[model samples]
Target chain A: MRQSRFGPKVAVAFSLALCWVLPIAAQVETEEWRFRPQLGLWFGPVTPVPGTHLTRILETSLGGGLFFRMNIPSNNLRFETGASYSYYTSPTIARLHSIPVYGALSYILPIHLPLTFQAKGGFGSNFLRNYPEGSRNWLPLGYLGFEASFPAGKVVNIGLRIDYYFVYEQHLRPPPNNPNYRLYNGHFLNFGLMVNFNLNR
Target chain B: MVKLRNILSFGALAVLGCTNELPLSDLLNNTMTLKLLGTYESNDPYGWLNLPVDDVITTSGVASSDPAIGGGSDLVNYVLNASTGLSVRPNDLKFYIDIAEIRIARGQGKAPGQPIPEYWSQFAISRQLLCSDYATAEPGRILQNCADQNGSSKLHEFFNGGFTYPAVDIEHGNYNHLGIYFRRFVTAPAVGFLGNGTFINATAPERTMVATFDNRSVYGMDVASLLQNNYGEAAAEPRMFPLQRKDLKLFVEAGHEPYVLEVRVFVKNNMMVHILQPAGGNAAVTYVAPIDWNTNHAYRDLFNGERQGGSLLMTARTYQPAKSGAIQFSAPATAGEYFGVTEAATMLTTPNMVLPLAATRGTNTRITNLPPGNYNVYRLCDKTRCSNASTPGGCDQAAGQDGYPETVAFCGQYTVSSGTTTNVPLALCSSACP
Candidate 1:
């Protein structure tokens, strides 16, 4: 039988709605909803597209991100989102800065222990700034990472994360008739320390 | 659990390795400098010889052998006043320098005589009047006025201060040679005296003859035949000094150390010569008098009619009937009568180089951020001239034609090292075509 393009989306949305409704119904009977507000320090190295003038102008430097999340009962999954900033040092003029907004789905491991592991996958839109004025680009990005967390107390969890980012292919417009212009696909790696507050507890 | 621990250890190592604390390559330390020392000598020992003025001739009154006929007094001293002829001096004169490839002298995978590829490899520098003081004046007026107002000086002193190339990154190695070329317009004065009864005055309409000293033209036949067989002389050639020095070695370093390479070049000015006069019987005396603003001080004695000395004697002066008996300074019947009267040969003396030119005193240029290495230095004639066998109707034999030949006159070898200053001294030939 043939299926409509929206059919899968509708089913996935219905399942997500049922999962949230069931968790809410159970929370009403059990007496609480689960939410985690996280604060983190993110840092890593970022490389620009190679074989372009931008590579010569920009170099790998440290950058960071901060995030917040809300837990769902079904499969121990959570909705996660964050804002991040990265920097690239320049030798000629000014430094380059990249700020991105990220959204992701995260799942905690089912291991029965005081310490837990989590995995996340997300998409982001990055806005690069502070380059040669009037030369800026918006990069569509993807993220994947792993985190290990341990409960410090009933209300807080301390975690460490290693995130890898992939920026989609893009091109920088060069002056007319210049043969040096090239397409860029950037890769960045970040490490962070997170402090999560269990608001529902 | 053990596998997870191993993965974490590898990840940690990779993160540490990707950190940005690694050092960047240190290419900023390479540099080379070519400085002008303003000290040079002439290859010819007996340099420029002064020719006599046009008016001094052998008549029944003043014989050629007379001590007072063509001696030191024959050189007329005119103070180049406002009304002097406009054509008595060259309009513009400049120096051109060229450097061949700089390469590693001795190293693995390094070849000799191969120059480093650089966009700034070939460039030119000129000596021109940049100040506004003489902006509106003619070249002759400017030169005369500057010399008169600023005391005796060289042309470069009143014009260009010095030349400095922008910073360049060169490879580290032993260099083969650096090439240098020079060109200028020399003005030879043909002055004489006109006389009315009992009154003698410097003549009008003094001829300022212009000559070019181009090394390429000196060896044009040699270079042209190399390019093509049966090639004719070029129709038009640039006014350039006919001297070149080539194949100088310079060494460059690969560190941030500073180096200063000074190139001392000597120019021969055709303005230094001696004039003789008969003091008494059978003995002619010459004085060591250089032109008003020249730096050469070498002197020559003209006696017994040797080296065309007989034609350089002065015969006429402001008529003083009581002291000197001359009714009038008669004009010469033929131009050849005054063989060496008006022309003077100028040379760069050893003493002048030791004492710097007064006008260009205390001028130095500092160039930073150049790659250090060995370079070959050369000097040659860089001018534009037409070929003799150029296609008819396709090429014109004008003075500034394209596809002109270049000639090398002087070539030598020197070395440049990092963190150390290298001085290269060179001498110009006294004769224009030597």
Candidate 2:
């Protein structure tokens, strides 16, 4: 991950570019409501528990959590935060799974059916189990993802997101069945499609 | 020599022009040119030129004087049979077995910038190698010999003749099992009920004669550990050398010079891959003897046969890649638990495939009748039965294969899409977008 020391610049550049191009989504006329539930997809790389065998194996990662965006009444910028539930299968960790809790800060890129990509990073944990001896694990995760939205009612919105996460942790697990050996580690990669009930647009 | 060199170079050169020619055949013949995506052999079109890094002999390598080829006792009157050291009821093998059915797919990994494809294809089949060398010289299993009564002529029907399932709901079918051929590891196999006579019913029973070898031969756990530690595990690509996780000249031996190795693999519509390390002692590569299907009235020996490794290695990477990274493991859990980082292995640990073996002509081994072309290779690992073949064995694709490690492993693909001198490095996998 040290190699990515320079990634922040490029990421920030792209984020800025999106920020300049998109205007804050016009406040949905849920005239009375102040909350917008967003349907979204969370994308990111997952770090299996250190010594996680399926850390790099191909995985089936699918997860989604609710997205809540609080509107800053006076400005175009809004505060966006959401917790996602993801289910992804690592090629090595064939059947077992990893779940993460994520929090994101977004710059609402504007358009009517607006599209926004969050430069979201958060802290989370992977509860790896079905193991002979269960172990507890959690790690810090950073995500650079994009979200696309389409038509919905005044306040309620539909969202789709693709996220790529950099799960910070070593990947390499001992053969779960026979812990005497080592297995591969597959990073967490997820594509989430969700329907959020927009409380505030 | 100079003239020959020029021909080789020119033969390799790609001509970039469209010309209106005489006849179509003549144009086609003149255009026997090719466009390849990988390295091609300048000397033999049938062989591939490796990515050599200077052939400066480092230490004048020591040759294995272990009879590199041809020298084994002629155990001609070979009665091929398999048996569990003890009579195992079908139920017993069930307790000791796990199965998987594989379906093959392909595609460019979904990355930031990759070609948006117009069409994609998926194949539902099992990846297992069934060495057809069941017949050598006379008095062999007539069925294994190409000339015998049940030889080559019968090969077609038996060789990947395309299996038929009793139901598409095969997800829960009995045919999904460790069948007569050990290579086919099916999911949810129905064992223990063989022709109404179960092994538990027998006073004292033994599965097959193969089981006798483990009892009779010198069991070597060190060898198994050495291989497991070194080779890691076998992915579906058998053309790979279990040692370096790359393709090196490899073969199975019977005796000094009398080596009969399985050099061919048959792909079938059956969606399962069974990697039985074979139930033998040396616990070595079991391409030595042909599988004995009739031993226990049930073609597939439940006790012996193939034992694969546990865990499957999928080709996906997300470790912030640097120009170069260390292959070592992380820290250890505690005492009694050995763990450390891995050194950079020969194979690339990246997700994109680096090598592929599409034909049986020349697999893993350096010598074979293969037409020259550009080829791609990669390092891949799949789930094998754990602790069921070797002292601590497990290698059944039916079981889940492990994930990729930090080591350098890769696969390749062919680019014969070019002109005449075809470059077809088939970097293939069991599934794509995985």
Candidate 3:
């Protein structure tokens, strides 16, 4: 009598999208959409939180990633699609090397003067390699980020990005009675310099 | 407005990420802890060594080698002559205990067929458990409930814990005999010292000889009397280590009531390796001797021809080794560890020259090709003892170290005759390093 997990997850996602649309539609601007290809780099530290097998033994590790993004700017709204390569390491066990390909939406804050702040959120699947016991799982990934950037030049902008990523991982056929082998969520946070190259320039 | 939306979105993701429960870490607490102590005694049935001849050394520092006229030339005779010391405890012993059943008898039965009352029944303790209820499962009951995860291979990591589940609260009445049924697989990192540091001119001051026991027949013993006993862990096959009354005690914690029955068992010299010589080979020509004992169990060396190298230190620069007398010995294979040897020289003309010698199993590693002089072999080790404090290798005696720290024992020393091959056979012993 096992039920499918797909239906409930889809229902919850649709509800979240509806909540987002009402407020976003009120501030929609009629500016023409402009497309730009960009390249970015980020580095930060990651830690396993409570409810993980490695929670007690795993040490904090510094991680880094690089991404190529396509940005379609329309007034206050910006649509982005990107593919990234992230790498992380632990002292005892585990090497988390993943490739996350995602589509995201960003909203520019209506603040005065020099610096511009953008709120970004995305959902995608992350393919991980070198997992514990050689487990290769493509985990569902979601991230929320905040970026503050100032124009470095007409062609490029140098800014700092803080992104928190969550990945859902499934157990690899463990003994059914032991709850210790259940599904867990892998978490990561990145805070580093992000330099974007505006392809239009 | 943007900051509020960002906070709400991040909070929702955080909730989704942290919804699962933490896995239990105390799964090992359910298994019983069986501590193995080594008791060395003459005429012990579990004894692996043939005999211990500690008092029969000649004044010349060589073991008296009487030629085999009729029933004499054997591994025990050859290897015993080269042994420095014997002990019950080895440097390391790791084995898997796949227990099937444990039964205790309340009465002393004269004949093997005499039936004794079961102790568990008298205490009203439940002996049967469901496989799904693994949280309270005893180590012996694992095979009864769950499928063997290692599958045919009984080699699995021993779960380390203090809590012995199926806690025995019953009193020790007339229960004098305890029988345990289990599957057999034991791995001992065999280490021994060869020469005494006494005679530097003829033999090494101390020489360490190291080997490993990947030999299944050498370490695997028949645990049960049942047919097809070697194949799997079944109730029909049972190996029993009868515990004496003195070894059984009633242990009660200081503030606790109801005395608990504690059974202490001693595993004898299971690591003792008997070195035997083949019957047809010429005593003088055949330098490589076959190592085994005549017993019910067959001994087969797995890692033959494995090359082992050790460092040799000469004690004195007096007698230089002549390019004539060769030291022929066999070094068994040890995987995943280091081997080292140091020797003191009483007759070396060169001052403190540390030479490297390699020994291979079933073959000869010639050291006679080196410069001629009297050389004293000092020490040999499976793991090198580093002199530098900063280097993170070798077993350290520092408090709270990772593993058990051990000292390298000095093997025996003997005078060497020129133009002859000296066979320094290695023996596995209970005591070492003194």
Candidate 4:
């Protein structure tokens, strides 16, 4: 597949976001009841299913996505939903992209410092872009993630997040008579940094 | 709080470092493998020989006129004066086998011995050079030989390996017969020289000719010229041959593992000869042999006799002791009226005129994943014409010229079992020529 021009650009943007937001986050105070909208970048390895002629040689790639979260009144849980896109690069010229739209319930851990750790779970639909024609277009997507966020300022914060995604489609399985018949699924991991805006603070 | 932080840390590490492995069972379960075995021969019926490269010289290197004729005439003598050094070697031949049709017979509303309707028309298989002499040779040499046999020094493989059909639907009734078709691979013509020449420049040069079995004057007519002018490109165009067999029986059962069909092809040597002697001692009479010594076989007779509607007869005054019984004679030394009778004769048993008795044999195995049941098989010569109404020219206009309205080559019934391999054997031999 042709090398995606989006990868390096995303990396440079993420690095710039981190450099600009970290020092400001260290000088900020904690905010409550704020809509924490996040712009993030992710880089990770992607392993394609064996025998998938389309993405047989894709092993790793870099991706990025934007997400938003809202803190519920008097609760440690945050409601989160976001959209993300990933690209798989391989020498077989198999161009593949994964786009997921998700909603999640994130629980904030009790901690003393300004940094907060959160665990999340979500469910959504992942639309595979640039896949081979006639294959399943969309798969049910499920995800689990963990993130650590620190206040950059009264309005801005810098955070790191790790998200694991699972996409599955019954139509992708082999025929019943074939010995290898099983559920067709993809497992992906995205880990990167996010810049958040405390909109209500 | 410390314990909860440790737990969260461990959970994050586990999710980020999860390992995913693909299932291997899907890769190996659906495909079947096939193996081929046997030997092949060229079986040139006309015994066309090959000339060594060293003996041949271009016409530009030789003088235009013959010194023996004394340069009195403008006719440049193109002579084929071969003496000894003649070798007979058949050129290697290779061809493809196309399994055009495969179906199982369903016994629905028909008698037990009746032919069944063809319900499956989705099977199409083609394997190249299944009958070759260099089946196990290197790829470079095999490709060169397949393209141009003249440049390769190694003997080509006539019978090679088998091929595999990864998937097939044999879920219905038993499949009993298979229809086999053979296609010729286009290659350069095999060429050879009859003899070396002694030009006035005191150099011996060789003349070249194609060693093809197609004799143009077989019916005392120039068929090649007629066909070329009338039919255009179809005169030398190659078409696939549908091989016919007498006894073929194969049975397949639904839900069986896989089945292997073994096919063996054989080509026989069918050369016949008849000699006619003189009626009286040295009378001034010319005799012509009957052309119908063999009903449909005349490849060799036309080659040795009158070539291109011209007589090869010669008149001689005196015969040299060494060349007394030779078929070809030199021009007489004295230019007076020679009263000897003109005789046209050829060594009927020369290697160039008679093909050596030989056979090419090969075995091919076809693997299919089909359900087991009792079924019958039949061979169709022309798939397009197999069902056409029989006319004066037979099905699809395939009769009349080449004897159409042909019967089924092989038909037999057998049963197939699921998960196990069934073997169906087919043997093909040449029909008698005379």
Candidate 5:
């Protein structure tokens, strides 16, 4: 069998979602979804592909983002939109600044206790800026991830979030004229702490 | 649930198939810098010497009386394999080559996700300009245009002999060999100052060194050989297509930029000397004396008369024009700290060869290539230090040179000749001279 590039990643995403939801299926159906507005902050490592120019020149530094989430009327369903910032610096002092804005459908797996879990999938555009060179472009990006949160108070929730992101970058310029340019399809994995405040509380 | 699983599987398979269309390396950070370094065998002084007509000869004091002298040679036989004179660096040096391609061979093991071994492959920085592109180009004309130290030339600078390429993509693997294909003709300016400060401004009759590759290496050729072989069609292609080196054992890893492709060319003992006789014929002499550029300001002063068949034959004195003379001086006095002691001593003059009037002590200072003329000398005496100059004596004598009178400032005048070096006497005295 020909191995798919995203075979392992899709399997992991599905398995995690199944593990968190299968046991709590009864809880998700018992109660109707209520409108809840949440503001969140997240920070974690931005890991590029292991053997890419990004990984070679840049560091696995922390990335941070702000997100807004609202539960829809559909049971265990929420619409999440967020903006993130990540930075990597090279040995030559060149820097890469990545900013991504995305919207995703998150499934809330409600359980009997205060603990809750969510599975998220999204597609967005990543704005990449290479410093010193001052070149910037927007690349197509997709990510699959899961988040686990616990209520801190009536208005605050804190937890950990991890995501596997894939970006497609293309170069159509012919060579000899532009010898240094090449195409890059980057893969990144991010994991960090997430703090969310319930705006509707 | 079934529909979601089917969609995820379809998306994963689609992405996998899409990625296989593009050629991708398993390793990243494979960018390597390639450098072409031209080095010399020894730091020996080398330059050119003219004959018959006494012209300006540029040398960095290459020849010395003793064969064992450091950075010099009594004689460096071109025919003798063991005799290699010092090959000094050439000032304003530039080399031009036409590179056809550069390729590398991979190891026997198969690359990741590949069925067969990734064998010999071409890099992204390959297939540069070819030699046949310059078939109609002339070295003499090209050198005249490109040899300027601070000038730009597309034909000379950008025709692909550039010494360094900073970003060459090499895949991750082990390499066994590297093949470089370039032209046979290597062009460079023949005129430059040698290590011993001998300047060879040979621009009129000959100006460039157009050398050909005799063997696999291009090291043994000197200025004489380059001059002799300076002819031939410029753009002619040779029989050999490429030059190669084997057993590189080069390993390129992913996420590393350590690989460097370096090519070194040796240039040593490159100067030549041609003896010119007044009687219209040349004679061989054993062991030529070391010519001093500083001492012998005049070229004609090197030899009194012609020597024929190993016998002294004095010819009539040929009247040569006056040559430029020079002035030699002892070292200057060190500047003493005078910050708080005296405000008037702020502009203290440190003596050097160029400023001969400001005399020094200990080391010898010489000013060469000065036109023959007459010059005057004067001095200024301060409380702490005295200066020998060509102006009226000024005094700040609260503490410096207290007893010295104004009359002592007139250190007498000296003349510079075409054949001799003027040794000006400069001294600091507290008392007036009788």
Candidate 6:
């Protein structure tokens, strides 16, 4: 089944309101409808980690994303979730360029002063142009990060961040050449910034 | 209970998704900078490929005596392969040479990025020599260095290939430095550099070798002191400000006012981001100015002149004549145009880096205005024209030096209301100047 953007189990806020007043309420809902679309970037080095010698990480990266944060009215804490599509490429020793598709998720905690902290994780896959086998590699599995969004305006959010990602393995078997070094497993230590939009507002 | 707990977690996650949702694809697309892959071989010292140039030479190794110098190979890997790439419509390439230094081949045994020893490096810094191990027809192979240097290392210098004007190519730095070269019609600095320099490639702090003294007010002009007195000026302060390269900021040192300082930035993506600052620490200095408004990459062109595998860098000054008997005025814009007398701002109409020539004050310097179009202008004081010039300058290439006499100053474009003549005062070259 195709995944619904809002997920499978969200009770409509109006339904929740009706449930509280209904003689026999069948739906379960608390009460809240909100959307804050924020655009921000993923700040991390391209390589799996800092010390890995074999794989040559291309460059540090940046991208934009949509952030929708729902808050319970009158509460300081907000339920946050988001997803973003980003692109990355690295040239193999054979001059092969591979592009990747990325996705992300997060939970946000907004403070009183234009600053918000978020914990985020995402997944992606690398696709090479012509390499038949080992062409598609899953993005390194685990990512744990924290980001602080600087609210530029009611609609715009600029962010500062620090993130770490872990690599599990390579998608392809080793290439025939000896000089080829693939980045299979490593840790990325990144300090970067981002800009995101508050969609619902 | 475990299954119920998992379901609850899933529900929590979905609820979170409702508000913070963003399309992953567009975010990446917006940040992805365009990169071009081509082999650039030059000895330009800065290995800067973006700034303005008068022309693009077709090939490298222009001659046999030329050194394995220009920008070092490391500079190329840094600017072209290392820095962030620029996102322009179409890309162009050039093999231009403005500075060349001859070096004793350190022996093929040396790998790329390996530093030449510090002591020997200075010998080459102050002087240019053939790879010491290589053979030379000139025997003693002594080369002419820039006139600024004073002592023994003097004979070791390389030739600067003076004034390669009407350069095979040129453009304006109206928007970005290379806009003068590649002609991006935009009127701002390159995008990828917007947030540069904040992060350093921790893997390597900048390499430190014996370069010219790093000063503040004088900028790197002190290298010229190798020619004059040691009245030493204070060091230029290091300022790391925001630029237009998209995601970076670099802290580079600079000089006094009136000199817009653009720095040559190299990233992993091989993009050229030029960061600018007004000549001095004038807090009021805010907007970026156009033309050689840079201070850092002065010696970059030297890398492209050598046989080294690095990118080349040339300052905005190459296309600009210095204050002299012939020309004492600065180019109208701080970011000088490419040899084509090109400006980054002018790219809006025609997307070409065609160079424009200069018109002097005296003599019926007639030029048939081609194509009935509006063109940004410039002027020259061809010293070779003055009869009183030291060599009675009349195209006596072997006997004459450069610049027009101060008496015959030439200026242009007094903002001529289009379809009109713009006469600028011209300076003639002086016999004392050289």
Highest TM-score model number: 5
Task: Write candidate 2's Cα lDDT for B145-176 as tens digits.
Answer: 12333222232322322222111001110111
List chain B TM-scores, each candidate.
0.31, 0.21, 0.27, 0.29, 0.32, 0.19
- Candidate 4 wrong stretches, greater than 4 Å: A1-56, A170-181, B1-434
| Residues forming the 10-long window of minimal summed lDDT in candidate 6 chain B | B213-222
Q: Using DockQ as the measure, name the better of candidate 2 and candidate 3.
A: 3
Q: Write the per-residue lDDT of candidate 3 for residues A19-58, one digit (tens) a residue.
A: 7765546435433334667777766665544455544434
Q: What is the DockQ of candidate 5?
A: 0.03
Deviation (Å) of B98 in candidate 1:
19
The candidate with the higher DockQ, 2 or 4, is: 4
DockQ of 3: 0.01
lDDT tens readout by residue for model 6, A1-201: 988766534547666766555622321244333443444444333333444532342333443334445543322334444433333433311112333333456656655665777776665432322111113333334556677776777777787766555533443233332222233443444556566666667
How would you encode candidate 1's per-residue C-alpha lDDT over A1-201 as one tens digit per residue? 878989999999999999779868887668665554554455555555455444654566776777878765555678788877877765333355767667888888898988889899998756555422323455567878788889898877887887766655343332332233234555656677767676665
Best prediction by lDDT: 5
Name the docking class for model 6. incorrect
Evaluate fnat for each of the predicted models and list the values in order. 0.00, 0.00, 0.00, 0.00, 0.01, 0.00
Residue runs of model 6 more than 4 Å from their true location after superposition: A1-48, A54-105, A109-113, A122-140, A170-183, A186-192, B1-434
Candidate 6 chain A weakest ten by summed lDDT: A126-135
TM values, all candidates: 0.31, 0.28, 0.32, 0.32, 0.35, 0.25
Where model 5 places Cα greater than 4 Å from the true spot, the runs are A1-32, A109-115, A171-176, A179-181, B1-36, B39-434
- The sequence of per-residue lDDT tens digits that candidate 5 reaches over residues B217-276 is 221112221111111212232212334445344555443223345442221111112222
lDDT tens per residue, model 1, B1-434: 99999998755433232221111111111123433322221111112223211122222222233433332222333311123211122222222122222212222222455643221133123222111122211343343332333312233431232233323333444454333333222222322222211102224222211222222111001111111111122323211121222222345544333343433333222122222333334432222111211111111112321122111101100111111110011121111111010001222221121211111111111111122333222222213233222232222332321111122322133333445443433242112112
DockQ of each: 0.03, 0.01, 0.01, 0.05, 0.03, 0.03
> Looking at model 6, how many pairs of residues clash?
149
Report the TM-score of candidate 2, chain B only.
0.21
